[model samples]
Target chain A: MSEKIDFSHVRFLVVDTNRLMCQLVKDILMMLGCTQVTTARDSEKAIANLRAGGYDVLITEWNLKPRSGLELLDWMRTDGGSPDRMMPVIMLTANSEVEYVMESRDKGVTEFLAKPFTADGMYRRLVSVIARPRDFVSVKGYFGPDRRRQQIPFEGPDRRQQKPE
Target chain B: MRNKPQFIPNRGELKRKAVNYKTGMEIKLDEATLKKMEQLVENSSAEFLSETVASLKGLREALGRAATEPSARKEVLDHIREEAFQIKGMGGVFGYPLLTEFSKSLHDFLKELEDLDELQQEIVSIHVDTLYVVVSHKIKGSGGPLEAQLRASLKAAVDKAKPGTKPAQ
Candidate 1:
């Protein structure tokens, strides 16, 4: 699977305040054949870059200076500040608590990678976002990728049931 | 309800156009480049670890000052927590899972130090000292019995200091 996916043309934007972490993420992306990887030290710069458009993916740390990655995500998904609201976003964080994961999921994160992650783990996430692209669903108070990954056949009557006339 | 036309004349054309547009934008990975990347990640660990050690040393010095300076305690503790947070994130990546665990404990402990009492200050000092030992010694893998012993002692001290409260695990 790693061999088949070509990241040479994919443009990535990495957002993190830590210089070393940014360098590490950049190196990993460049190693995966990504030629253009732009990085921002904080959410403001990242948002400005996103507004300019052309990035195919965004990798951001959960904690950023002044504003958090979640706040940035919320702005992108709902504020109409972004050129592409459905852009693939991968969140990086050290907090592996279930609450954090759930919060990111609910906020419309495409993928979540816990820190101290391996190269293979990062690659897998890249592949998951690119190869298995999920359809975005936008309804009242909800807008993002389909949360459900597995589909089961429904043989019975319409389970939703018709609304009262 | 009236029956509607099942077919839309431009639907197939739209689908075909979408496919043609996507075919030109497909991403391709170069095998050679990926192999180079794997090697780079392997080689970068040592450099990363050394940098981490330097950062930890700086944090230790700050922690020492924060312990004694009451006026600057709040600001210094915040800085220490931020540094510890970074260590927590990168420690496991550089082959020091125990460092990550201990740093996380330290970060959590620092967060709960709003009203730094003398005993709380001592506990913070212990965490900083222990972290310095762990990072400087390059303690990889589990610390085994020694790790357990350290944790037990720290926990006992913290419990004694606070009373009716468990220390960060």
Candidate 2:
């Protein structure tokens, strides 16, 4: 593929209850050539920053202390959110069973990373997600400075595809 | 009678290796942690296992794509190195000493891939193949045995890189 992902522009927000996972993911993103990486230990912090804007990607662990990771993913999938309903999410967890893939697909998860991941694996997943991120609407606003509702249509070639207000 | 499945000896041998790996690693843990993990292993629902397996599959696919990128070779090798480091550190935490050792050796072997000209592609292929085996073992619920195999492979790869050792294992 001749496409080059503009590294400086891609922003990431990582959410994981596990400190190890967060740090490891941050390091992996940095290694993958991602310059902007923000981390949150829980959904509340992640959502707060997410509301504030600027993250191009969201990666969260499947298991959490206060709430389940899937629950958080469900909340983010609703109509009114920064990512809208189509934001790209990569779920990282120790749960490596087969059935969960179906469940994650239903929740709009773009990718999954089992715990004990290698840097190469993580980098590739990040590349694939960034290359084709899910675009959703944030109830509060878009990824930019303005709070204006933006629809990122992922179905066709034109990424800037619009929807009727 | 509960429907019974016939077992081939080779498959049984592989399963036996897996179980032996689990038992051997169980001895390395402290009393408290081992007990806790045992409970977790027993109580773990099938749903959790399935999710873990899917993630591993995704990771395997990612590795496959990365191997073909000749220009991204350096970046990909660095990524592989990082993976080995994480596996080494976390494998022990998760009760897999064999994986930790495997990760250590794999990380070392991956480092060698950064410089060699003639053998670089070959080394990359070996690493990816080893990774596939690891994922397959995990799916079969024999991640520990896979770890054992990986450790041996990593060690052999590392040894080959050193002076005086045979380059092929």
Candidate 3:
């Protein structure tokens, strides 16, 4: 793992309603050498900024005013909301329940960071998006990163490699 | 050879417009900077907890009012639930992981308020009392035997109040 990330030019858009939480995120990014950071207090404003373009990544809370972050992700992936549909998104929330994790994974989220996250935890997610970008899967009812992080050896035939009839 | 017109593109102007894009990255934080940011986060969390304690006091007052006035029960319970939700979400972030756990239990109890009989309401009151103690003491992390005992008693009461709802642990 190289310790030479240059976030000086990577633009980020942070969407969170809580002022304190937003400032904490901004400070963390700034400390990481990110200079181009934009913030939106709600989903509507986030959409407007996304449409304006030039953002490299997005960090959003699960709960937001007017629209939830899940809802925003839905629009971004399905409704052609973002100019770059492959843009990486990290979903933040206090709820670490399995249901919420599954929901976010199904909704095309690039990464999920639970609330009360440490600086190291956040840094790992950022590195994941930039260093190890996941391939997008557009199968039935799913249109996001491949949910499987590990590949298991199989004795059976490889279905993924089978040619279409 | 005849001297051709000299052409010099403004180097400074080109430098200003050049975009420096680099991907496949890793963040490296110096020890001093990391320590400073951690301290800032801690300070902010302490301030947040102080403010939260004041809010909790207000919630306790609202609970008292609800217990006394039947007409205000619904509204007061709603307010308590809202506050409990906030506590559940923020407690872990502010270094009070135990408070987050307790508040989650309280939030669940509040959700089933309408189904609770008088005995069940009493169980909820016990939970409220325990939360007050936990927050006032500024308890953090996994509390010791005392906290365990508090949780066990509350669970027993809840089981007595609403049998068959919770599976035996």
Candidate 4:
């Protein structure tokens, strides 16, 4: 049985310096029936808001004016103050460089958005991310009751599942 | 639900291209007319600059209106298409290749406007700004060197635009 997605009570945090972009995304999200959406212009403000909680998903620009989104993600990974990685982050970037995509993957970013995406494309990515498992812990040296790290043994003959830290 | 009736092009649609109500004489862009156009550019006045500014202001107003009202947006967009097409034809005839090229680009932007979401508005606004500068220079009779600036700005805007899944090129 397929489950119906309910976004009426969900909240999304959008971070981008462009006024027109912020408004446009807000409008599109509203059209998608999202309620209680918040927007941040820079990484600093976005980090602050992220600490405040209540955000279900984050849609952030790759190139921000003050600090880039990659820096923000790095800070979140290093900072012990944030909650255990529970929300999905969608990086909106114009950079399609292979190096950038590889960096994003290494950092554990959930997904990426290329420049000039359509409304439906944005909607679909959001839906897919929301439905996926949100268990991600970016910190290297962290072990506590909140941490739910599980190591699965490799079954295949050749492939190996790297040991957990 | 009922569908609106569609009809073929009437006498008005088939008529020759001219401001029919303005005067009975067709305004053809001949060599003499091209020379006169060149003269119009040479004797640029503050009023001419103001007139171009006024047109840009109208376009800005139309964009603002389109942001809110769907029907009004459609009407304004259609008007822009018609005006831009006319401008493109006239610019080519007058040997203003830059004007013709920019007008064609602006027309493409306007055509693609409706298919874009709100997030794309920033780049669209930048395009509008560039067009405004082009128009301003045209009015000043000094658009000879600004072509490079306009093209670079346009490329930058396009580069910054986030790619959509639908391939919004």
Candidate 5:
């Protein structure tokens, strides 16, 4: 595969209730050559940062005090004040389960990375959200990155292909 | 929901800003770069050890208070669950999988029980104590046979304590 990434301009917001997690992620980001990294312990603080704008990506843990990361993702997708509904979010948490993955996906999370995450894994996610941004979907209830990852060929009579409203 | 899933093209602001075809910066992390990142995490191992020790101390004290004070049990249990969860996420990150394993079990157990019974409190206490031992000795990896058995035994004790209900994950 080809490699094309530059973290010099990408601003990051990491949300986790644990000070250790926040520090670890920030350290990893710095190691990856990112200088503009902000830390938020709860969803509320995360929102304040998000509203200020300029954050290119969000990395949050699932278990947060007062408000969960899922709730933060929900607000980003659905809240009117959210500057970027299509903002890429990476859910990095210890809640490693199929159910959690599916739940985060439904909540419009761009990526789901379980904890005990490697720096390599974290870097890969950053590359994806930055270098290869995913197309978004906006429907009645949900508004964020499109959840469907694969595009299987449909050998059927009528297949609709158009930019949705 | 819309009639069809709309595919809103990403304006590629991030891509434009972060990717420079001129510089051709390879997003892939090389071995040396990866090593540097690993060292960054490993460098914090000492911090993890000391902080975890203090955290477990808090967990133990909270457990003791929950045992003696009936009124504090509700709030204390919530705090323990949150603390255990933080521990669960950190241990494996700092080369202490056993710490994660035990605390994850503790966290899940706390999730299952709204209020701790006498047996429940004892089992939770054991979980807290085991966590203390793991971090205190700087036990890394998943641990040996005895440690594995201790994890299994904790699960068994939870099953026995709860009887009919399955433990939360």
Candidate 6:
């Protein structure tokens, strides 16, 4: 049986240097019936809040003060002091190019929401993280959600032999 | 260091805690909620405009100081790039695509520059000025033909501003 997703209890930590952007995101989250939303202005403050705990997801910007959001995400995913490595991250920023998306994906971002985004877009991403979580993958020099999105079918015996890492 | 690959399934605590029987299974965006979000942005339009104006001022000031303050030029350029990047992001959301497009040029120009030359500084000034025009007039979306011409001119300026950038064919 399928399950219903609710947002009223999920805690969120939004990090952005821009006041308006942060407020806008907070307002949108509130509109979606999310009761617990917090905002931080920079990566440093974000890290502090994360360390303090109680956040289920992080929606951050690409540009931040003192340190960029990518740096914060790196720390979250790889740092020994990371609060929750599995916390979903949505990289929302003006960096909407393919390269930026690829970089964020490689860094373990759960979703990428480019700036000029719509309310529906934000809602969709939130639902995705809550309802469609990906399995985590850890390997040498990498740890993140599974990078592969598709599964291809191969008929007959396996064509390649592989040694386990 | 270990090379073993490990797969960990997501713990469904978030989902379990958020699940409700009355809400149903099929997920969909509520139109009324979206409308409310739009209204919220609309309510903040005035604030966005003022903040954008302030951002433009910040860009102009940083660019201005980069010329007079040699010792602080690097710091100033970094500030300008950050402010420009911010404008490039906010303008579109607040209904000023032209401003975003214009400042994107400024951001790109300074993105790789450790130091700026005379011509590059001029290019930065030009972009900041263009952003001012857009913010002041509240030019929404892509502007008219004149704005298009301005965009093309800025593109050419960015390309030629570099020492060895090839001319577009």
- lDDT per residue (tens digit) for residues B66-91 in model 6: 78888878888878888888888877
Among these predicted structures, which one has the highest TM-score? 5
Question: How far in Å is the alpha carbon of A108 misplaced in model 4?
Answer: 2.0
Q: Give the CAPRI rating of model 3.
A: incorrect
DockQ of 5: 0.61
Model 4 agreement with the true structure over B1-169: per-residue lDDT tens digits:
0132122111221122212334321122235533443444334323333544565577677777767876675677765664454344334322345545555666666656664345444555666677677665553232545677777777676666535535446
TM-score for chain A, candidates 1 onward in order: 0.90, 0.73, 0.90, 0.78, 0.89, 0.90
| 10 residues in a row with least lDDT, candidate 3 chain A | A156-165
Q: What DockQ number belongs to candidate 1?
A: 0.32
Candidate 2 lDDT, B1-169, residue by residue in tens: 0122211111122122222322222222335643543443333323333433453354455455566655665665665665555554455334344444454555656655654333544554566566445444443333566555665775566565566766655
Report the lDDT tens digits of candidate 4 across residue range A40-140. 99888998898988776788877674778877765555566764253567777644457877676566566777544444446556655654333343233
Q: Evaluate all candidate structures by whole-model CA lDDT and list the values in order.
A: 0.73, 0.54, 0.72, 0.56, 0.83, 0.82
lDDT, candidate 5, equals: 0.83
Best by lDDT: 5
| Candidate 1 Cα misplacement greater than 4 A, ranges | A1-3, A156-165, B1-39, B161-169
Candidate 3 per-residue lDDT over residues B1-169, each given as its tens digit: 1132222211222112222234323345556756766775777787667767776788768767766777777887777776676677677776777777777787777776754335545766777777777777877757698778877877776676565575346
Docking class of 1: acceptable
Ranking of all candidate structures by their TM-score, best first: 5, 6, 1, 3, 4, 2
After superposition, the stretches of candidate 3 with alpha carbons farther than 4 Å from their true spots are A1-3, A151-165, B1-34, B64-78, B111-125, B160-169
Off by over 4 Å in 5: A151-165, B22-25, B164-169
User: Against the hidden reference, what TM-scores do the models get?
Assistant: 0.82, 0.43, 0.76, 0.45, 0.92, 0.88
Tell me which of candidates 1 and 5 scores higher on DockQ.
Answer: 5
Q: How many Å off is the CA of A132 in candidate 6?
A: 0.9
lDDT of 5 by residue, A1-165 (tens): 565666768899999988888998998888777889999998888988999988989999998867899998898888879888889999999998789999999899998898777878877887778887887876777777877678777788532255344
* Model 6: CA > 4 A from native: A1-4, A151-165, B1-4, B23-26, B164-169
